[model samples]
Target: MDTRIRRGRRALVNWLERLHRLAPAKSVVWVPAGTFALILVLWIGTISRIQAEGREARQAAAGATSQVASSFAAHIDKTVHDADVAVRWIKYEYERSPSTFRLDTYKEKGLISAGTALQVTIVGPDGEVLQTTTPEAQPVNVSDRRHFLAHKSSPDIGLYISRPVLGRVSHHWTLQFTRRLNNPDGSFAGVVVVSEDPDFLTTGFNNLEALGVGGMLVVMSDNGYLLSRLASGEHASPVGPPASAYREMVDAKGEGFTDPVDRVPRIVTYRHSTQYPVAVLAGISEKVALAGYRHARDLYILMAGLLTVVLLAAAAIITATMTRLVAARARMQHLAETDALTGLPNRYLLTEILRRRIGRERPLDRLALLFVDLDNFKRINDALGHQTGDELLQNVARRLVRVAGNKSFVARVGGDEFVLVVEGMDVAVAARDMARSIIDTFELAFGLRGNSYVMRVSIGVAVYTAESETEYDLLRQADLAMYAAKEEGRSANASRYHTFAPDLAVRGMRDIERQQELQYAIQNNEFFLEYQPIVSLDTGDTLGVEALVRWRHPEKGIVLPGEFIPFAESTGFIIPIGELILEAACAQFSEWMESDPRPLYLSVNVSAAQLVHGDLIGVIRQCLERHSIDPRRLKLEITETAILKDAALIARRLKELRLLGVRVVLDDFGTGYSSLAHLTNLMVDGVKIDRSFTRGVPGDRTALAMFQSIVSLTHDLGLSLVVEGVETEQQVNWLRRFGHIEVQGFYFCRPVAPGSLQAGRAA
Candidate 1:
């Protein structure tokens, strides 16, 4: 026997065993048969009647849906034909007698007509009312409407219907139809607009009969504004633009078929006017459309109840008809096939569907399997407890059913993860915007146990096309897409079934290796120091040495700070690197001070990261005390641009460092954010003139003048200046001639080890 048959037999046996346990053998066997047979007969009759009613209900809903659709088409046909007639008549009269059919003449001739509470107005291209049949001469602008623009820009115009809008001129509802007016030379002279009240079209919406018990009829704009509804209660109060519920549907454009306006299942349909861009929507309640299905469902429930009674009676009759051993075996089989929760189809049933879908050779239409994972679901389970999380999942499942409607199938694959299979839709519809809408749906602040928490969903969409030849391939792509979404910061990301790019994979590997290398560098004391001597131009004496950092790599030897410093900064490892440089510089300075106590300062270049970090000052204080070095022997060199940011704060911080006897020098003085105004705003010991100006001064006249001016300004501001990159006697002389500027370059000596420096003046 098949598994389902065995399970059914086991379920019957289990019912018999329970009955035997409750009552004596004679009563259990005799009494239940009599009771169950009568109940079964009545239930069978009830189900037959219910099914007939269901079939009738379904027929009625289909007829009603068809009726509403037909009425809308009729309304569009009538409105466009009437508008075409009115606009063309005005054009004909104007062409016949341009002078006689002028504004006042047309009104006197009764050329314009009025209907009910609606009026018609004909305006020229310049916005002047040429003729009017309205109670008041309403000033109107036709330039903004597409109908008017179509007439204004083109000559081929009879009539054009514009999108519905709140008429600015009338302060009442109106639809505009424009007719083009042309000069004898075929140039656009003006346009004639016929304005009609909206009731001319809304009458169709007002007349739609009820589709079912819970049915409703509504007419809305392409932009989702509710123009009118057929429901009796003050439709106007809530009858305006669509709210959050219809937002996604409207954005999707025409024929946005979805479900449930405030949990009342609905069918939404839209049609765009062939004559114009205007859109009309018709919404029918799902309760009404599926009212027939409810009757079928009610009949099924009755059948189940009747079957339960019949089984009880049969079991009583067969109290010992089947052997005790067979009854026990059957009961065990039934338990294995059923799910404990939800009582819906199990994994086994789902596999059967997948197998059948894949076996067919027919061209499968576009199908998408979206694997949705709840964000922060684990956090909710951990914080609020699992019971609340379980309830939240159930609610999410219900919402998915509402959103997916009958167009898609949804299943709970595992904890907090749901699978949605939407068929016969374009794959692009499952992309980012739709994913965002799904997330927004869950973000509506879920209420649980008197506490509200926010929830979000990340969907990984896998579309089955000709590329996906197998079911496994489709499932794998969706799983990979889910992982991609999580890795890329987890709101939603979609991936297709393709190999990961080599370049991106290589980059990820390199990052991991680099992190490990950085960790090793930090652990081992591999960092060392190098000092470059700064020589005085006027006196030709060694002034100071700027401390530079070098790394003694395990494999590669002597790595420059420039090579590794950027990596360190990007990886946020610069804090430790800066500390190493500061400590080493201060200790080296202390040793040099003992040999030459005559206050020759040591300048250390500081990166922007080192200066901006909050703990830098404290690190500096700790290093100074540890080295037992005089603070005055240290001069901090920073760029002009670095100081320009929050100058007031930097100045205050620099003042404190200066008070501790440390000198501050501005490096790259001319390269960035350099201005005389900054010199006054910031308190610095000296400025290191950038090398560009010095390197070009001899060859370029502009460079020479700028260099000369900078030198003069440094003295005027009462600040000392260092001219860097001086390589020859001539360059040194040119810098000296500028007066009081100190120079440091190859003219004196190249940067050397601290011990290589000779303090004596040049002969």
Candidate 2:
């Protein structure tokens, strides 16, 4: 047994020595050198074969995806076309006989004639009902909807189908299709509408076998409201498009998309109609579509392995006779550093390059490192299909390489993000140029399949100084700069050491703190009403004081409205803050009126969000009743933007408030777009010149002329004019010449506390 063990050890040692002799060596002149060369050739050939097979597999996968997408789109296109034809026919019938095609005709014909057709209704131009097939149906006003009005005004008066709505008459799921009736001379007339059952549209999609598994097919609106579906399992409940998918698809007009469902391996195909503006979505489980492909791929892989073995066997025979070997260490290294999806360098290569560059003779060279992040990349991936997304990313990589020239290093970090390292003596200039070029690259129209896709990139650049010695520090700075770029809407933003100055860095933090403090001030009763007495220019009696926001900071003492007012407006904290001030001012006026019995009004500023609030009138009514104050004594001040944005909504809100006896004044009149137009349209009690013209009016003739013209126009329109930011006697005198006397400014009082306000009364 001992002799056998010793013999076995000797045999193992001899085998290891032979393997070592086969190992690569650069010193060999011909024999072993030729062997190594041959070995390398064989290895390269094997790699080439593997790469070819991989490319073929990718091509097959991409082709299958394209085929499925095309098939689904063709099916949807045909379905929509057929539906359009049916709708056009019905519209033609209606236009041919307007009176006979009315709702009364449908009622007389009854359910037998209509068959599965739901209740029919006819409506006039004003959205008022002309007639209905069923008397029990609830009244529906169609004028508020844009789609209904569009068809009614169209020259062809084509049939218009709304997204699915629950039927009021039949109480069944239906889509309402309407056709417009025109007078003999092409004048406007009433509309004839018919309800169609959802089953009619969903029948074709109800039964589809995808990869031999149960899959769902859904139809939805452009905004992602579910219309119909063909699944009955856990997905029985109606569902809209997924949030991620919906966001991606809504902006993709007249385009078809295929993307994977969240976590679940499924393909979602969505297309929006150019005619109806609705989206149709269909999905099949991806696990099922690729089942056969996966099996074939696996078989191919096995065959490839066998082929590799056969080649190796053939090589071994030739090599044994010729004493040749091969080495593929360098080729393997190159493959490891490259990206398979895009032929660009991977993150690993980026790091390696960065390390080497930093360790060179000129270690302290100024370099700019940029983090390029594709904005809304997920949208591309979701809307254009992953194959398209992959193609786009490759194109983007090539563009970056071209734009960077030979002076920079560009690599795909992960997903749609790429890192670019620019080595230059002037880091800042290089960084700015690269960022501008990258941003401009996506500005041009990108055409794909007759559809154009516009994309944008957010770039963050960090310039490495001599202080940045380590890779981690340099990368960290780049990342921080990238975040800054994202905050700036991702076009181009850089971060520098000096950018962290005390004032710049703390502004946002301070604003956030102020917002929180103001909210707390409201809740803890730390805020109090401070009224600036507004005296009448003619009578010398105090008209009212504009209620100003004042925060009584615990440590910082009293802070004026100017300090925290902007912070409040930005954070939407102003809504509640403004309400608190309104309630407090009204209550104070109620108390003051009871003692003096003088006619006094309190003016409070209202934000855009507050003006748009549906309950503004209700809140005003509540505050008046709570304070036992008359509504006429309270005035609401609104900025120009507030009234101009959705003028109809603001007009309605203001009209309601006016009806409740609360006066509405358009404040900061000239600062927003079309201020004069808004002032004329809205029933405003007064117009206040914005502080910009007021503060500069005293010396500048142009400012004075603009201010005078505004005053003249306000008076000509029978609206009172008030000057804001009246500071020195010169400003007040100059304003008086323009017949503008009612003013608020530092000359009257610097928004003082209520206790000290009486001492600084203007009158």
Candidate 2 lDDT score at position 93: 59
Q: List ranges where model 1 is wrong by over 4 Å.
A: 1-501, 641-652, 673-677
Report the C-alpha lDDT of model 1 over 1-763, residue by residue, as the tens digit: 3333234334433433533422332333454565566667766767776777766665565455556655675676566667767777777777666677754455556655554224455667675666656546656665666666777777885566554456555656666666788877777767766776554565544545544444444445444444444432224333344533455444222222554343455555445556554445455666657655785777677777767766776765566554454466556533443333332223443334444455543225456666677767876776677788777776676665555544454556667776666566454464334455666677588888998977766677766665445666555556556645665644243222222233443555676687777778878978777776776666777677888788888998878887887777767677787788888888878888788856677888776666655567888899888888778778888888767555555777788888878888888788764566667778887888888888997879998887777777778777778888888777876666765567777767776666776666631
**Candidate topping lDDT:** 2
Candidate 1 clash figure, as a count: 1
What lDDT tens digits, residue by residue, belong to model 2 across residues 42-129?
Answer: 5576567666765565455445433443454455556556555544554565668766765455446552134434546666777766
lDDT of 2: 0.64
In angstroms, give how far residue 144 of model 1 lies from its true place: 99
Using Cα atoms with residue i matched to residue i, what is each candidate's TM-score against the true structure?
A: 0.37, 0.39
Best by TM-score: 2
Among all windows of 10 consecutive residues in model 1, the one with the lowest summed lDDT is: 493-502
